[model samples]
Target: MEHEMRAEYEEGVEPGPDAEVKNWHMVRRDGIKAMCGRMLSESAATQPADRWGEPEGEPFCFLCGAVYLREVP
Candidate 1:
């Protein structure tokens, strides 16, 4: 219940210039495709899904490198 409520209220914010990025979560590639109708998933190198170990902190678009952050707690 708590998780659902938190997720419902989650809003993305752009961190300040002085803020340091300690972690990152890649935005869903599928959602991007649906919204923009463009392919940001296919990688010239390793596929995004093929990557390992998700970090914490800022949420980012893996394809475009746009970062979004939400405060937890």
Candidate 2:
């Protein structure tokens, strides 16, 4: 099946030195919005190229992961 989902995260000034950084989210492959309902930035890079192997120690959106797993075939 053709994939309809991708990984995304916030990467810009909004997450400044003082601001808490947002977690990576699983999003629709065709759009910039995350499965957790958060709208990712247009500048946010997608997976593979981002090389974000399993969220692991990195901050990630649990909600997005839950939804993504449920949606997967």
Candidate 3:
């Protein structure tokens, strides 16, 4: 089954001076996996249960409580 992806602005941290704030768009399954992988790789600590499940499917961001998933284009 396919999934739905959603993103929201992180709190406190404003977009960088040169950062161009844009709407978060839906990406593919592989793309979502890659994105999550990169995020995990950057973090030194293990992801929380809310962010990373045992099987590593779509997870919600604890910081913003936003859910992430693969979205159909």
Candidate 4:
């Protein structure tokens, strides 16, 4: 199940000198778009590299330290 990621940038959300900083904004600037309870399944050999939409890199979940493999449904 692949999801098309979209980010809505807010003007004062980057912890600027203003007080109206929104918390979440496509926060996963990089890495998996959805967790799907399938965290850290990256190193598994069942899937090959050519299938990845993004070039392979060290993408890890910043909050939980999980790596996800892309498997579009």
Report the Cα RMSD per candidate: 13.6, 5.1, 11.0, 12.6
Model 4's TM-score against the true structure:
0.19
Off by over 4 Å in 3: 13-73
Regions more than 4 Å wrong, model 4:
12-73
Compared with the true structure, the alpha-carbon lDDT of candidate 2 equals 0.55
Give the top-scoring candidate (TM-score): 2
Residue range 1-73, candidate 2, lDDT tens digits: 1223343434555533354445666666657777788887665544531333354314667787688668767
Model 1: CA > 4 A from native: 1-14, 29-73
Residue 31, candidate 1: C-alpha displacement in angstroms = 7.3
Better of 1 and 3 by TM-score: 1
- lDDT score at residue 42, model 4, on the 0-100 scale: 21
Which of the two candidates, 3 or 4, achieves a greater lDDT against the reference? 3
Better of 1 and 2 by lDDT: 2
Q: Write the per-residue lDDT of candidate 1 for residues 22-66, one digit (tens) a residue.
A: 233333442323111232222111224323234432243342332
Q: How much is 51 displaced in model 4, in angstroms?
A: 13
Each candidate: what lDDT? 0.27, 0.55, 0.30, 0.27
| Native-structure RMSD, model 4 | 12.6
* Alpha-carbon shift of residue 36 in model 1 (angstroms): 22
Sort by lDDT, top down from the best: 2, 3, 1, 4
Residue 50, model 1: lDDT of 28
How good is model 2 by TM-score? Answer: 0.60
- Model 4: lDDT to the true structure: 0.27
